[model samples]
Target: MNLKTYQAQTMAQALAAVRRELGKDAVILHTRTFRKGGFLGLGSKNVVEITATSGVNVLHPTEKRELLNPSSVRRNSHTQMERKISPMPPRSALEPSGPAGRDHSESISSTNRSVSSKDYLQQELKLVKQMVQELLQQNRKQQHPSVPEELFSAYMGLINQEVTRELANEVIEKVRSQLGPSQIMDDIKVRELVAETLTKMLPAAEPITLETTGKSKIIALVGPTGVGKTTTIAKLAANFKLRENKAVGLITIDTYRIAAVDQLRTYANIINVPLRVVLSPEELRQAIDSMPNMDLILIDTAGRSQNDDLKLHELKSFLHAAAPDEIHLVLSTTANQSVLLSTIKRFSSLNIDHIIFTKLDEAVGVGMLFGVMKKLNRAVSYITTGQNVPEDIEPGSVGRLARMIVHPQKGSEISDDNIPSIAAGEIL
Candidate 1:
């Protein structure tokens, strides 16, 4: 391998110099920019530098010879196969004339080495081919050619918002396809179309209400640890019982953490609602039956680690006993996209009806939530912005969430301030 460095005023010039010296097959090792020819760190000129290498020897002599001479290689392979099947006669029995015998032994030894090298080369070649195929496939699926500057801004905005590249591309492509040339020329119109398309992609369910005419609704909050499940439940409890004037009861099976139980108990006391702490699945059943007259029973579960299958299954057993009407899989908006997906997959054993995203206020970017909602295909019911009870929670809306993800500067446009507040006397 030969390595060389080139410096020029611009990247194009530096790249050209590298290619001219190193050839088209050159591999770029590094690139950097620096200021030079300046006195006292003033009036410095910027220069682009590139380090490149070429003539890298990748193949062994034996492998190259075998690749170029297929007939001789195949003949040698056949001879090897026959030798393996039928062992060679003893040296004393098959000994040839002195010089010829030595030559035959050396030829056999060389052929053995060649065969071993061939096997190794075949494996390496297979791996290289697989890598090339994968790279080609990825290239095919990568984003299309650059769009006009106006459209490119929208595309990059989505990416900056943490939206998946594939999804962002799809959104841009959809907008491009639907709009006419005249419409496309207007950046505002194009951006609005993109936002509208993203908003429509998010599905939201009706808010859980205890005032319904149907049978008493039982809702369970489940999620991985530190996702704000207990706090979210407290918010929901306050909204339903204190704010909605409906009979609401609380049940918690999160005995694993003493703090968790105390937290829910504190919320129940503040909200003036009956609270039950059960130990086992049978106890959970009893807790459900004991709260028959309650308009709604909000169950708070322990925040189990998604990777702990045993604990998750145990949690599922409790859920099986209660058989709640709604299982709200609580997730934190600040969580990494991969962790959120793992949590969802782990908790999927129990039926999930709605998704509750908490800590939206703390999230740097909520665009990953778009991918999560789309991939899970579960409707979002509520999104909690802050720690304030009942104040920070809002009924999930497709338009609100989509707008937040696509254009985060616009605060959640869905209004909850005017939502009717319930009378305290009704809870007693």
Candidate 2:
């Protein structure tokens, strides 16, 4: 039994050698290729290594039987025994399998390799892919362009009507530069822009806040559904009652939804404030006018769909009855960028003075913030994070908003130092 190395320019030549010396039962140990380095006119030569193991013990029974113990054989038997040996063809005399077999084998190997690669990448590339995808999404959302929406959309034929990052940024920056120094626009620079944009859309609030100085204020919170209007109103209520010592009254214009009034009523209970459920605009007006001894009036409007002009206008009739002194437009930063913009536009005509940016934590890109303030010229009064009553709401200004937009690289939860690494140069 012996192990031998065979070198050949092609696999067929090497395999033939193995089959010839070790027969059809022979097993291939290993195969590899090496190439020299070269450039331009230089050509690198290729070399192959084939390890072949041949032994009667591990081979066919015929080969094993051919081996006999010399000690058991007599010296005269070699001359006396004249056995006729059969002649057989060797592998060096046979033809190769040709190129078609080689190509078919390679195709089968490639298909199997691709399936294996999927499993390998899924296990090893999870974090790396997540990081790259996050970054790519961020870049696509942030780089706004200044061209007109129609022109920009025409150039690219995007199905999503919202302005792309390239176009949005271009327009926002152009207008921002024109804005005089008085406008405090940080990264969410869009706040100031939105203020400017909305100013043209909405008429001035009909300056008639029914201010009853010393008495408890019956304030109602109102807006379309899921804008965090009810929750924001609660926060405002807590701030007024606890911080300002203003006796606050709660009223809901959201009797249409089953738990709408119940939700606000629960808030009223938490703050130890009394709440009124008004089903009609007339009742809504009557309830607020009746609370004449109240200091501030916060009215809650039903969540109206932006597309429902009739319903929104109908709701406005109720709001118009009370003549809200400070109408805050509560916009969610996590909302679709187009929806947020349209809501601000639609609500502007209804006498919205200030905007509240909710769910900033849920927002990954500040482009909408920039769009609302700088591009649209809207004023933001505060930002609310989580749903936790007063604990989650904060008075947001340009400084904090700017910091969030400018520096977006947040630290990873896993410490870099804690990650294990292979020893230097210890690679596969």
Candidate 3:
């Protein structure tokens, strides 16, 4: 048997070399790809290697003839039928203890080796095909021709910040479409255009506000476990009672956690506002009715896991009973986009009026927030930056959120006062 190995820049090239040297009858034993010729892996090029063998007929004469020509097999079908009928020999002749038996055993072993080699080749080809597909997908993502070179950095920035590629492309494409051939070359102009485009995509920020008819504004906060719902409730309560000097009432249905109830009670006492701890949906309604004179009533419910259907059902019952003027779903920015989206989808049945993003200061990037808001088309009412009551929380601003998505490094530096004003009519 003759065995040889060949290497080339591609599988096609490598196989061409194998066919030239080993002929068409050669059997492939193995194949692999590796990087070659690079300093510190900087300029490496992919090389394909193949191992093949020839000069060994692994197939029987009839099988080889059938494989080489299908039409011949149909023409010789009668001969094949005769051979199959006369295949059996006497037991002693088949099991002869001599050099003949040894040659028969050797032939079977060679056939087995050929079968094993064929299986190995098939498996390697499957893996190689999968790798090629993955490389093609990565290349398409990296070299998306629709995004120009000038906006490529901005596109990558959005991706690194955890924005979905689809959304990033949408924003970049919008920027490209708006900018002229000359403006695309200007880096600062491109950045500004990207920011402006992001700002336009955002829904208008609608913060909690009271009506002029002296009617009480009932607002409730709901979310999943450990998302700082209680703390956010305190911030909203304090801001209304202490800062705005409006009559504020605090109600907590968070009886599941004694600590959460106590925490809200502490804030109620500090802010010198009325506090109600309700157990059942009936009591929740009664609590809201009892605080009719208050200008703003902030209700904080116990955190329920999105996956817990029973708990979510109970939460919905409570919200239905309260029937608050606004239902703000409080979400933490620390959670990833998928989790955030899933939570929203689960809680969507509650008729979520707006979104309240908490833990903004702890988030690695606010881009996911932008993505969620854009995808859901939900408006943000408030954003909590830290743990400080009334101080860390602020009304949601589209300009501020857009700037953070565009310039993550300068997110911490952006403030309500410094956020560039976006025209209301420009909102998408």
Candidate 4:
């Protein structure tokens, strides 16, 4: 047997070193984490040290066959019993008390210790394999259970679409309750029933439009960084001003990034709308007052980090000042369910009632949107499918969203002709 020790800043690096030197058959003996490379531990980083061993003996197929034979097994068992019952040799008679004798005894002891360690490792390895197999079987049973043959495909489709297990179970339960057992076996009927149930469960708000509300509608867009808040705002501004001929105003509190301001300003300039850049809550109030004559004031806020409480609080202060008529929390449909939920929970402080899913065209699986809508129950206002301004944005209709969840490849069927130039009364 060969033993080696490796040290690295991370366990992954240490494991890489072990594999590089000992090949793939090495067994990890132990690991320890300690501080390294700092003065008096003030700035030290944690380091991982790994101890491993290799050179385990693996029996060949011919040797295993010979050992498994009945006659061979009997002979081997008898030999083992004889050796166990045999008397120990007298130390004095076996070797003289000298350096050579001491060296011989030490060598035999080392060999016995190595043999014992090898046997222990083999036993542990066998037990681990058994445990792993049992766990895999259990996991498979949990993930896929016995269901009617007709509905099995629909159930698998839901799981494959990235819907969470709990929500998928809910969908299945609803199908079971709504459809009779005879119809449950009809795959097409089962899928239709599931889609219909999901559609009702998903909440959708019509697009924000100026015709429904006589007063100036103050709409604020809030969300984390890089979720395309600026672009989505630009799309809304363009669609409202150019298509609907409504008096549009723009105010952005996103001074955190120069490019964001420049980007929004560029859109404002193209649409011939006034763009106000406010730094504090007081400035936001002044900006809102300045836009009183405008029919709709679209306010863009700084992209905040969901986990940064201070930033979110600062955002809350801005929202308090503006007191917008509607707050839309922009999100990406491509984000995983956990991240989407966390974003929603953190931003819930602002009393956000609307959601905007951006980058819909980039998502391979938008079924996560179903989980999000089910959890938050907040109506989604629009979904931005592409980068093209005004054209890519569409109202998040219930039927379209449901179809996207059930059949992702089919995508939203809401044609460009059907989407209103502006949100009807939904924004108000």
Best candidate, lDDT: 3
Cα lDDT tens digits, model 2, 154-265, are 2122213233455444544454555565443332344435324323332221211234456443433444579788888788778767766666777777878868788888
Off by over 4 Å in 1: 1-143, 146-150, 411-428
lDDT of 3 at 253: 91
Estimate TM-scores for all models. 0.63, 0.49, 0.65, 0.64
lDDT scores in order:
0.72, 0.54, 0.74, 0.72
Superior candidate under lDDT, 3 versus 4:
3
Tell me, by TM-score, which candidate is best.
3
Per-residue alpha-carbon lDDT of model 1 for 1-428, expressed as tens digits?
56687877766676667667766555444455677897998988877665556644365466456644545555665444323212111121111112222123334334433443455457678999999989965664465464544577788788888988878888888888898889887877876788788876667445775545746789999998888888988887888776677788999999988888898999999999999999999999999899888888889999889889898899989999998888999999888888888888888887888888899888757788888888888877877889998688876665566566556566555343443332211110
lDDT of 3 by residue, 1-428 (tens): 56688887766677678777866556554455677898998998877665666554444556644534534544554436222212122121112122222122233223323343344446657999999989976786677867776788888887888877888899999998998889988877887787788777878787886877999989899999899898888887777777777898989898987888888889889989999999999999999899879888888888889999999999989988998999999999999889999999999889888898999999866878888887668888888899998688876776777777677778778765643221122222
lDDT of 3: 0.74
> Model 4, residue 109: displacement in angstroms?
57
Can you tell me which runs of candidate 2 are displaced by over 4 Å? 1-222, 411-428
What is the model-wide C-alpha lDDT for candidate 1? 0.72
lDDT of 4 by residue, 369-417 (tens): 8788777788888889888876788777655665566665566553434
Error of 3 at 11 (Å): 51
Please identify which of the two predictions, 1 or 4, would achieve the higher TM-score against the true structure.
4
